[model samples]
Target chain A: MATEITVGVGLIAIGASLAVGLTAVGTGMAEQAIGAAAVGAMAEKEELFGKGLIMTVIPESLVIFGLVVAILILNLVG
Target chain B: MLRPKQMLKLTIFGPKSYMKQVIEELYDMNAVHIEDYTKKSDDDVFDIGNPLSDNEKHSDTLVKIRSLISNLDIERKNILPRETSFETIEENVTKLHSKVSEVMAKKEYFTRIKEIYTKKEIKKALSSLRLRFDDEFDYTSAVYFIGFVNAEIAKLKEDVEKASKKNMTFDSHYNGVKAIAVFTDHKSKDDVEKVLEDYDFSPIDNPVVKEHFRDLTSAPGQRFVKLDHEVKAVSDKLKRVNDELSELKGENMIFLLSSEKKLTMEVEKGEAPLKFATTKNTFLLRGWVPRNKSKMLKKKVEDVSNSKVKMKFEVPGKHEEVPIEFDHPKMVEPFEAFMELYTLPSYKEIDPTFFMFLTFPIFFGFMLGDVGYGLVTLGLFLFLKMKMPGMKNFLNAFIIASISTIIFGMVFGEYFGFEFFPPAYGEHLVDSLPEHLINALHMHPMESHGALVYPFPHLFSRSHQISDLLSISVLFGIVHILIGLVVGFINIFENHGIVHALEEKGGWIMIMPLIVWLLLEPLGVITGHVYDMLASILPPLPVLGIMFAVGAILTIIGEGVVGVIEVMFLALMSNILSYARLMAVGLASLSLAAVVNDLSGQMIQSMGIIGIIPAAIIMILGHGINIALGILSPFLHSLRLHYVEFFGKFYGGGGKKYKSFGYSPK
Candidate 1:
């Protein structure tokens, strides 16, 4: 029983890291395409910078949510 | 704020001769937005003809002035025009053009003569050498070569002795470094040349010289001196011409600017007939004038054209497109920049700039809730505003948004993540903080007796209570989406009628709150406090099911049955959930600030007093990055929520903008 509990805690730690880290990768992947296109649009018309910036950052929330889940897993459990 | 200002369409008719005067007056007044007469046919009494010819003298003078202006490289300034008459300015410009051209022509002629004369003289001097290429020399027996070599005659003499087996005689001319002329018997010339090649010899072209040297004492080497002197003389003359042009430019700067402005206006005036409907004796002009400015416009037309102009006004049809003109208060006007980033609001639709103005700052401030960062941002805003006034609207949004950041930062009690707070709150971090930083950022972190006093209240902290923050974020999502739906409802109720609003926007408005309340059921059970609250006020799950059923029915009626599945289930649900991003972004900023403080605090403890240096450096660098991301991230997200999530509710903009047919000196 003690070993089972130890393994469970270990898995949870890995899960917390994986959760935030994987989501960061996902957000970065999403942003790569968006950022390139945004830069292209900005190059054509300088006024598009605001819209480009907004679109470029929209996927960042994915990682933020991931951080929340990671924080919960890291702190909330015994 | 919601609707565009009222507009009145006007028709102004005048005699063909008065057309130019009428256009000039309207342009000066700068009130009327012209509707070009291209839509009308020639068969109609008001058919517009081709524009009258531009003033020939005006165009020619403008061309000459422009050339002079560029040639002089005048620095353009918004200086007041000098009170010089058109005739006087024109005469001066003509004279300046002629003077510059004369100097330029002299320089050009000198350049041409220098190139040809130098070449001829070099050959003449070379022919005077009389070693070869003279009438006494026989071409069949020997060959003559003249060119520069890598080695001078002294160096070449040693190389020639070593490399050549041919019996060739050599003579060294006076310090001949560049000029090396070789003569050898035709039978052994190739062998002698092979040895010269070892010395890196390169032959200069011996063009056929028809004339001999003019002076017996002149050295062929001295030809470079003469050519260089000629080049310098021409360049000096060119510089003098440039100086004269610059002086003219300095004295006549304002006159040139004024002439350009006057000519451009005349051109626009002359072209007015192409836009208006004209006959042999009369011309008709049609345009939209703002209702408020119409009275002034009418009076100006009468005064400027000697009452030869006749004007009329009429209301446009309901379905017809009309140009939009916004009349926002000066303070709220900057939010128009946000509106323009997406699209302009449709003619009949309400402008959402005011709604965006209020919400955007709130979202931005909440996300970047820190005092030092906010003040820094506000400082940056002021700097940009001072530097680039033309970017007023864009910079003003940042200025206004920073105000919210300061307020939220104070509420959060976070000045660079509590570096300013007293060490008593967190005992582990106490040793890391420098003495001054504990009271820096204008807040002292000191304990009062046994009791603890916070610098400012934290209404809702981004750092603590992660789960509760998520819950609050969900709640915020519900409220925000509900507000969007309500705006949609109001928009539809006015533009589209109540029944459609009730079934479409109204259904979601009713359904969203109930769903949020129901979803919280599990959390309430675990928390106990919310369970009791839910048990006391809210009904069973069946009630939620019934409410959704009714809402789905209304959605079906309004947007057809497919909309319930696609829009209500997929789109609406996702949109409400998306508002959780607000909380997520705020937490990200909080986490970054806390990490910086924590790292710096810990590292400081390790180094003690000396640690303060690296710690301060780390804090500055970390916080600098944090501040840039803080400003741009929150600003962009706030704008995204408005453009993608909020404005998606009721607005679609394709309205033509109102542009007054007027001229100002650029």
Candidate 2:
């Protein structure tokens, strides 16, 4: 019997790729909306602009979530 | 804890009162009113019109005149005909004005006539007259000298005019009114009158008259007249004051106010509360004053209320001290603290914070179910919570989700989007694995040609199969509804009683699981070749009917027939569909990652190693972008499902938070 490659690598790779891809997409969309709102808010209230900008970037954690998955994929494949 | 308690109790007195004082100081102090101070009577007050800086000199002059008049004290004594009849004063003033006007007209005519005529002819005529009086005396100071000189000159002019008028044949009665020019030695009233009369020239010619004329023209004399005029003006004003004081007479002497009637009225009534009944012997009054003023105000209230009525002060908590108050009140502190882990947004009914915590990890783990991803997320949230104070909230929230993801990843049998668990810890955890299980569930992340799985797996390993998708969906559905039911029970029980919870939410709970289980079980009496596989699992016909009967009764008892119908229709549909999103998001993340890998893989192959580097970079970047999108999709969408689909079954919002005005930013 010709032994197949371990499906473990494939599952993890797919999972990680999904994790990274979905996270990046979700956060990017969220950031676009939130960033626009923050910029608008900043224009209105300059003092609160810094804080708003920071908070707008807060949802970017989704990207971090994706990056982690990508790193996991790299480690697993490597 | 110390800060939390302080947040709970608002300070009764402090900076707020000081702030009030600062405000008081900034604006006009006299403008604001204070209670308990009696306003003085304005009856005796003299209201000077708005005094400008220029009024300083005028005021000084007024003061000097006032002193001169007061020194005489005639007006104060009320001896100066106390009532100077306006009519008599008017008549005397009119007559005096006419006399002055007549004298002024005569002087103007003589002066102008002199300017018109020859100076030499006028001098010759004056000298001829002066030679008649005295060549030794100055012509300018002659007793009626100007009049005498003008008379001689006038006589000459009249003879000429008489000649001219006689020659022209006009009326001869135009010698102008016989007005005598006054030249007095004294400044006395009689001296001026005598000089004006045709008789009594002795008084006008007296040595005193000459001295008086000299005195009238002197600087001190002019100053004296000004002084007298000022004195008279001051005396007249003082008399007006006396008149006003008398006219201000009244029966009841209440304090007069210059401010608005309401505020001044409030001040006068001892700052009484709006609801106070003055008719009653004692009254109850309550109002908020600044914290700094609390002590002083309490003392004032005690003094006014005579210590009979009590005073209370309430100060609300500050944001930093009890930021949770910015959230909710009735929530138990620990729950509030837990909720605070997720922001307790003031506006939302459901604390989506908890929902975020519960759902984010599930979504994140499902999308990025690698042990490595979970660990990374966990570490990131933890570090953020520790290091960045501002991000501490987000960090804590994410950390909680990451932990959930880590746990869920283990259960899902996924590690880094892959199925590496069995190989990694095969002997220790799962003794065996299976054929259909690995292939269907495993997520391939490697770029290698192909991968296979070890055979013979346990039931848990088989839990994620495609056939079991419905069952998994049903299982999740039960959990979701149960959570909603639990929350409903908690909510109703908190507000109403347990009886309400049972009446409303209890029935659905009992009916849901029973219905699912009954449907899943086979219940067939047909004994045919095609039904052989399902027939073994079917309950006996008699028992099946009885089971149905019990379930029907329970469904009716737990939820009314209508409720049962609604729940069966709505809850089952919504709950099942809600789970669909989970699968959808999971698939979406997986598919996107797969596409990125495939695209980049093609690039790498076509371009060679150098080309592969760029392809690999693109893959990394593209996959990175997708991971971000994936993380949020599961997280927020899961929350949406929970908040809208689940929690709607059980939440009521609209509790008015307590707001105290004693301490505020103003």
Candidate 3:
């Protein structure tokens, strides 16, 4: 029974890690294109810096969602 | 405070003769945003007006003064702006122009002479050939080729002797590359030349040599000495000319800058009529003025034109695109820089500057919550404010953000990631507080050895209270998004009536309660009693389901199936969840500070007296890096939250910023 509980805890930790890690990778993928385009746009019109920043970080919400899900998984299950 | 300043369309017409006067008055008032008149191809009634008389003269003077300023490298910052009358400017500008032109001409001449004589390659060639300027060549009997060659002198002589049947005379000298002079009879000149070509010989131009030293009858060394002396004299003259130009710059820089400014204004006023539509004898000018300032503008124009000009003001039409001028109080003014950095609110849309002013700093402070870090950043921003006055607005926003950091730091009871104070302080002052106050603060006293020590009465310990902080962050997100939706509703209602506003923004607002209920229900299970009370007071789950269904239907009606999906799944869910950054970022900062403190503490304890150096170094460098990231990360995250989430809801920015005529940017 103790071994079963330890295995369960390890699985929960894996689940939590996957939740954050995969989403972070996804966020990075999304931000790669957006950040490149934003930098290109900012190069032409410097006033677009704020808009470029907003555009570049819009995908950051994906990572935040992942983090929240991880926290919830830890709090509710672990 | 929420709306831009109201603008009225203004149209003024006058006799062509009074155009200059009216323009002058308008410029002095600095109230109008002139709309350039584009001629319609179909209309033959009026055409773009010609510039006023003397426009050419003013333009010419302005151009000349600007060139003079650039030529002298007289920076505007170096000279104080002073008032100079037009007559004085006119007289002095011509005089300075002539003086500057004369000096420039002399400098150019000396520079050319210096360039010509600085070619030391010719002197090297002459020295290699062992020749003097006075050395005469018998060009009539023998042809000579004197320059550089890429062959051995002995081989060349043998080859040339064989080619010309021993009829040629050769003299040679070698540096890195060989220089030779070959003298041959006319008959064998072709044969010698052919042989010389095989050896890759290049002949120097003789005319340059003759022209440079035409009057000299001395040897090459004596001639070069004379040339050096002449070059020095020319350089001295060039230096003197430069000194004169600098002195002239010192004397006239202020006058020239003042004149340039005055003439530019004159030229602008003179050319103002070019933007007007005109008939044979009358001109028409159309523009916009602030509603409150319309009367003043009209009066000023009339006074200048002696009532000859006719002015009309009218309220703008619904479809008209008006320029936006933010009307915010002084304290809220700095937040407009954020709007400018993004895009200004359209004239009809609500200005979110005031809202950002309230929320942006709170978000920033929440993420960078530490008393020591806050104080450091606040001092840095305040110091920057004094040093860079041009960026006052941007820095002032950070100042407010850092102040908020301090407030949040107090609530978190964190002093550089420590509880109330660093561990070096031994015991916190909270431990000495009276029992009543400690109880009121909900802090428990613990037995430490024999004495009772009360923890700091912080509302939240960020490092330990992760669950609580996460919940609170989500709660703040919900409230902030709700505010954004309400503002969106108002914005839509103002522009597109109530029904559409309800269908769009109201649907989201209706769904918010359900979202809140769902989020809180989980918390209720964890916290127990508060959730029970909330559950009792709140609508049942089935009712909330009904509300969600209704809200979803409204969203679908407003924005179709895609809109329902976007508003529900993306905007409402992801946007709110994005505020988790507030917790995550602050937690990250706290964790880093804790690590630094731990590492330094361990170093100090383990290494004894010598540990002090590395520990101090680590403490300074680590905290320095943390503080820098603390300022940038929080500031950017807060801005991103507002710009991407909050402003995305209601702001339909792309407003034309109101820039009035004759107003020069400093």
Candidate 4:
């Protein structure tokens, strides 16, 4: 029972960190290509700066989603 | 505040001679949208007006002076334009033009010559360098490629000789590939060149001549040096001339702007005839003017043109769409930019700016409710407002939102997630603070030992009541969307009457309250026995069943069968779920704040006295990142919720904003 409790906590720790870390990695990957394209578009027509900004930050919510999942896991684990 | 300002369309007419005066008066009034006359008849009836008689001359002068102003990069402070006579302007511009052109021509000449002479000098030096080989004769069928060679020049020569299938002699000094220039026969040039490709042989810059470099360059070097001096002298002269022109521009900045406006006005007046329908003598000008300004325009025109110009107003046709302009309270005016960003509400549509103003900050604060962050943001906003007066609208929004955040922060009792007055002092802190302050602060979330208490009572604890917060967020979303539905229903009801309103918007309104009642027992819990008694009157499952049936029927009646059964249910549910972002984002930042504090606290413990600096640095960076995300997340999500969730309920926005002919500050 003690070993079970310890394993459960270890798994929870891994899961919580993985949730946030993997999502951040995904956000970074998505934003890299999108931000590149947005900047390229911005270079052509400067007025698209606002639209570019909106697009570039759209992936940011993904990290927040990950944070939410992490928080949920931590709540259960802690 | 709820509706766009009432707009009236007025069409006016006046005589040809007084048209310029009429236009001047109308533009000065700044309340008329000119309708360009479209050709409808055979006799050039809807022709555009000719520009002013001196428009061409004025415009020509304007272009020169405008370019001069831009080139100087001057920021003029004077509001009043200095009145300079046309004759003075003409004379000065002509003189300046000639002088500028002369200097520019000289500068271009010097730049070209300098580039040419610099290249010539490099080539002359290359040619002057002595080579040990034969110099006197030009080979009839062969070429000398006197270029730099690599250390493997001997192998390259063998490759060239083998590939060319001809006699080839290597004569070059070793400075690697840069110094190697091959001399091979014309018969074997292509083959030798092919061999050279692998060896990386590129000919030097001076490709035309192959002679003793010393013999070629000794005499011409002096001439190249002299050209360099001439370039330097001309460059200095050009800079002096450019400075003179720049100085002239600085002094004449006001004059230039005034001339530009004068010229543009003349152009508009001259072109007014095109919009005017003319017979032989009299001209008729027609356009829409605001109703309130119609009488004012009539009086102004009569006063200006001494009763020579006449004006009139008429009600537009039923189908004719009028331009829209919103009237909002000053405090709520900044959020109108958001309305403009999405789309302007059509003439009959309810202006959503006021609604957005009330809800945006609430949603923003709900997501980022932290006292330390709120104060910091508020201070930053105030500072920026002082620095940039023109950006007041943008800064004011954050100021208002930050105030909301501070209010919610006090409610949440979250100062960077540090437990200032832990649940141990929860009741003490609440009782100590003023009632309004206590009520505004939601301090139930702290989790210290002993009975958690609040003097004024908190709605819920964030740390302990995540599920409650999530449900509350959904409730808020429901209330907001329901209000939007009500407004939409009222708007449609006023415009298209009962059945249409029901079909268009009212069905959603009916569904909202029922969904809240049927979906949760917490609504009852939150409201005490009020919902309990209501549920007792109709039994829980039966009430849910009845509400669902009514809502479904109403929705089907309104949006057709498939829409109510599938589309409406799915979209509405997703929209409600979207509000979960509010709770999630809020907790994320708060948790991050706690993590930062934890890490720093750990550092301080681990390293003792020396760790304080690194701990502080980490604290600064971590919190800084969190704060940045704090501002950004709330702002964007609030906008997203507004633009998607609320507006999606019922808003058909695409109206032309009303613009009037007016004198704008330069």
Candidate 5:
């Protein structure tokens, strides 16, 4: 019973970590392209900074969603 | 407050002779946004009018004055603005231009002389060769080379002697790089050059001949000494010229600045007719005037033109794209910078500045909630406001945000990540309150007394009440999104009628109640028993599930299948979940502050008196970094929430901002 409980807890931790870690990686990948394009646009016209910042951070919601999923997973199972 | 100022389409036409007077009147009024007249290929009745007479004269004078201003570095703040007549400006400008230009020409001559003498390498080479300024080389029978060489002087001389087989004189010296001068007869020059080329010789110009100073009958050392004396004289003259220029600037600073202002206006007024459509005998101008100022504009134009002009005003048509001018109160004016940074609200849509003024700071404050950080930022912004008055509007917004941060800080019972009241004080305060009041406020007398304390007399401690904070963040998100949806509904309804509004925005509105219900149920604010009792009359899962279903169906019907996925999950669900950043960011800030405090405390405790240095350094550096991040992160997150989440729902921002004629931004 003890071993089973330990395994269950360990798996839950790994699952939670993966949920946040994979989404963060995905967010970074998405942001890389967006940040480059945003910088290019800003270089041409500096007034595009606000719009560029907005565009670059739009993909950030994916990581936040992943964080929410991780939080829910820990709360519900652990 | 909600919509842009109303504008009327105004057209004025008059005899061509009155064009100048009318334009002058309009410039003084500063109320018109003129529509530039374009001539269509097929239109032969009207063409763009020519600029007023003497336009070139005004333009020339303006350019001269602007150049003078730039050359003198005359800033507006250095000179007081006052009226100056056109005659005075014309006379003074020409006189100043000649005076300044003459001095400038003398300065340029001396600067060139100084440059020639400062070539130290050429001076060194000439001195080493013991060459005289007046030395004559017979071009017919002799040749000389003065340059740097990569090979040893002995080897180069030997190799050249062997190759040329003629008498030659070689002078060489090393100052970082080899400087060598070779003098040979013209017949042997080719053979000597061949050997020098193998040695990688790089030539230097003979400065005496290049500078046309070869007439001086003196050795290189004496010539350099004379040149140095001349350079000193030139430097003194340059200094005197600079002083004279500054003196001239001081005397005419006010005259020049005021003249610039007047001439600029003159030029603008003179060229104004070019924007008008004209026939052989008359000119026509079309523009927008604020509705309330139309009567005044009419009076001014008629008075100035002596009633020679005809004026007409008409309400804008429904399809017309009118320019937008914000009409916000002073308190809400600062937030307009955000709108300007993004895009202006379309003429027909509601302006979001007032709403942003209310909500943006709250979001910012919620994320950076700590009494110490708030007070620090508030003081910082206030200091900045005084130092950089030009950024008043931007600083004012942050000032308000910091105030909100203070309020949230009080609610969270945090002061620099420490509990506002220590445990002993908190216990005493909680005891003094009435028992029922304590119960009502849900006060707990004793708890952790470290950096994060959850005690009575204050609201939930941010660090301890994690779940509660998350729930409240989601609640704020729901309320914020509901407001966005309502605004969207109104916008669509105004433009496309209630049918489309109901189909598009109403679908989202219907789903919000279920979202709220789902959130409340988990927090134990509502239970299944209430819905279970209504289950007999309503359907299973009751009103909430039914509402969700209908909302889903309506969304699908309104936006098609793809939009259903977009509205339900992407827009509605993910956007709300994104607000979780509020809790996450604040928690991160608090945790960092706590870590800094704890680390410093441990350092001081374990290491005794000598540890104070490192501990203080750690505390200062750590809190400094945290505060810097605190300011930037919360501000960006709050802006993102409004721009991406809230504005995405309703705002269709691409309206033309109103720019009036003769209105210069200061």
Candidate 6:
């Protein structure tokens, strides 16, 4: 039973990292596309900088979701 | 069969007589025609159209201004014209243009003559003139700079020579590194030297020569420094030209004396009023008129405006159906009923608006579904949908998805960071926790799953069993489909009477009851011979006599063979499969969650004790992502199962959406 608990906790850590890592990677790639678009928009209209910032952050939810999973796993195992 | 078509169309004839009127009318209709003249300008100068005399005069004018401007100072404001008449403005502009050319020519002529007066050539010239000279200054480097200036001049000269075959020569004064020169009809260096000596006899080191050389060395030194002065001179010249041009404006300004009397003629086909007028031998006109009144309007305009003006019939373009007398209250209700039933339009008609509703919730729930996540998402969507001015509708759909997630969370025995009921609550709380201290909803993770029995205890003991999960999913699917069919019947009955409704609605109603009976009979929840009879209808149909009796009675009295066949086919197959959604969505969620747990566990186990923090992090993040993706899967598949497999049995969606033309498009 102790072994199972320990293994579960260990698994939780691994799962958390995988989710976080993949999320970060996904968000990073998404941000690159969004950021490039934002810069192009900004060059034309400097005032849209704020709107572009919000739009660029939209894809970050993927990473946030991954982070949530990490937290849930941590709670379940630990 | 004899209803006149209401689609808009128009026709016209006679190209020359009607082209101008057509263009003007089209413009009023918001049709854009862009004229492109840049291509002509960028092409060869002659191709753009101008005679040799005009071209030469223009170039000469440019040269004259170029020289004067090069020597003078003028501000930017002076060169530009405020307003002027075309003809007088053209004359003044031409004079200024000539001055610019003259300045450019003088500058080029001097630069070339200066280059030719090299140190070696100057020394040779001096010796031949009996004016002995020695190099008291380093003049070699100046030769290169002089060479560059000469190369530019030579290129300009070559261009002119090729164009006009005019030879260029000038007089030059030199003192080693510096030189001053003037251009004239002189043919060569010898001719220029003779003329310079005749003007004033001087030795090689003459003070005048020294001064002249000094000025020459400094002349090109400030190439860009005198730009402001040159610009000022050009401005002054331009002002003088523009002043002359302005005076001509009084003479050239056109005032229409008979503009009001000039009749605007229009040519059109169909019943639209003429949108434009143009001078023509005979007038023709066309424009949009109401469908009902178009014929009358066309005749009236032709007769009243005089038979001299020809008129034709035209119809307005309607990209959509116009409201007609035939579209009554009942025809519109089906679409609303259809939307209410499935929360989406059927696929037979492709409407992109339905896609937004179906995908919005899945996206919302996926982003937020944990009991903790659900409340937050629900709150956020409600706030935006209700409180925000523009996002109300978009957020409203999101709220629906969030509510679904909350419902799913509750069924799954989930709460804020826990489950529906804690297992320890029954034992520990009853024994240890005081009545005042106990919180009814609070529960430990270990306690939650145990305290509550599975919704379908017959099929599942464990909360996560695939069978139980599937049954729940299909149960939802069945109900969703049944609702869609009920709505479909409402539409059918309204449109074609109960006879039509029976053929469609009877099948779904029959299938639902039989399936409900079978599921309930096995659980022993209902004790009746009806279950036995309904269950047998699936395989043996021992009650074929009963079914035939009902069929014969219903058909003879009312809904015929169609109703009987629908009941048989739909009851026999579709009803049972409609419940497949229960299995599909339930399994989809459980398997995904399990995979997330398993994969995250493996990752942690492989890493040693040093991997503890990283493992925990991985598990949390992985499951979080899985939760989001998990949320979308169930909602979408659930909706899909209802919309397609179940509701599709009765619903055919191709109802036209209402569009108001006079309102602003959203």
lDDT scores in order: 0.69, 0.43, 0.78, 0.68, 0.78, 0.41
Residue A13 lDDT (model 5): 77
Put down candidate 2 lDDT per residue, B541-575, tens digits, no spaces: 66655554554455466567776676556455445
Better of 2 and 3 by DockQ: 3
The top-ranked prediction according to DockQ is 3
Query: On residues B1-666, what C-alpha lDDT tens digit does candidate 5 reach at each position?
Result: 999999999999999998888888888888999999998876568989888887888898889998888887787653433566677778889989988887665555445444544654355444455543224544335577766666667888888778665445556554445556676777787888888887655555555433323433444333443355545665786688789889989998888887787777888898898899999999999999999999999998898888999999999987788899999999898898899889999988989999899999999999999888999999999999999889999999999999999998888877877753565676677768888877765575543433444353456677766666776777678778989999999999999899898888898888866666554554332223333432333333577778877887787888898777785564676677789888878988999998998898789899999889999998889988988999988988899999988998899989888888883746
Q: What's the TM-score of every candidate structure? A: 0.73, 0.39, 0.79, 0.73, 0.80, 0.38
TM-score of chain A of each: 0.82, 0.67, 0.87, 0.85, 0.89, 0.84
Model 2 spans > 4 angstroms off: A1-78, B1-364, B375-391, B410-464, B467-470, B518-565, B598-608, B656-666
Q: What is the C-alpha RMSD of each candidate to the true structure, in Å?
A: 12.1, 28.3, 10.6, 12.5, 10.2, 18.2
Candidate with better lDDT, 2 vs 4:
4
Docking quality band of candidate 2, CAPRI definitions: incorrect
When candidate 6 is compared with the true two-chain complex, its DockQ is 0.04
- In the order shown, the candidates' DockQ scores are 0.38, 0.03, 0.45, 0.13, 0.38, 0.04
Chain B global fold similarity (TM-score) for predicted model 6 against the true chain B: 0.40
Mind giving the per-residue lDDT tens digits that candidate 4 earns over B1-666?
A: 887766666655556677677777776787877666677767774455565577678778867866655655556443443466777877887677676665554445344434434455434334433544456434445665654333366787778778665443544332211245565667777877777766434344342343334445465333222344534654675577577767766676676666666655555655656666765556676666666767777778789888876666777655566677778889999888777666788878788989899999999999998888999899989999998877788789889999999888877767876645534466566657677755565543333444443322334446556755766676677778877778878878877889888866766665555556643553221223333444454445666666556766777777786656654555565565567678888888889998999899899999999999989998999999999999988888888888777888778788778877766553
- The true-structure Cα RMSD of candidate 5 reads 10.2
Show where candidate 3 strays beyond 4 Å: A1-5, B77-83, B97-246, B420-431, B439-457, B522-537, B567-570
Best by TM-score: 5
What's the best-to-worst order under TM-score?
5, 3, 1, 4, 2, 6
Q: What is the per-residue lDDT of model 1 for residues B1-666, given as tens digits with 9 covering 90 to 100?
A: 778877888999888888777877888788888888775454676666665565666678778878866766775666554566667867987888897666555444344434434454445434434443546555436565554344556777665545444333334332323345665556656766887776544343433221122233354333333345544554565567567667767786777777766666666666767788877898887888888898898888888888878888777766666788887888779998777777777667787777877788888898887888999999998999998878889889899889999898887777877633454654434445565654453233344545544444445455644555555555555556667788788878887799999898877765664565645663231123333444566566678777767777787788886766654455665565566667778777888887988799888898898899888988999999999999877877777777777877777688788888887544
For candidate 1, what is the TM-score? Answer: 0.73
Error of 4 at B162 (Å): 62
Deviating ranges (above 4 Å) for candidate 5: A1-7, B42-44, B78-81, B105-237, B420-457, B517-540, B567-570
Q: How would you encode candidate 4's per-residue C-alpha lDDT over A1-78 as one tens digit per residue?
A: 123567888889799899989988998999999999999999999877756766776666566556556656766753
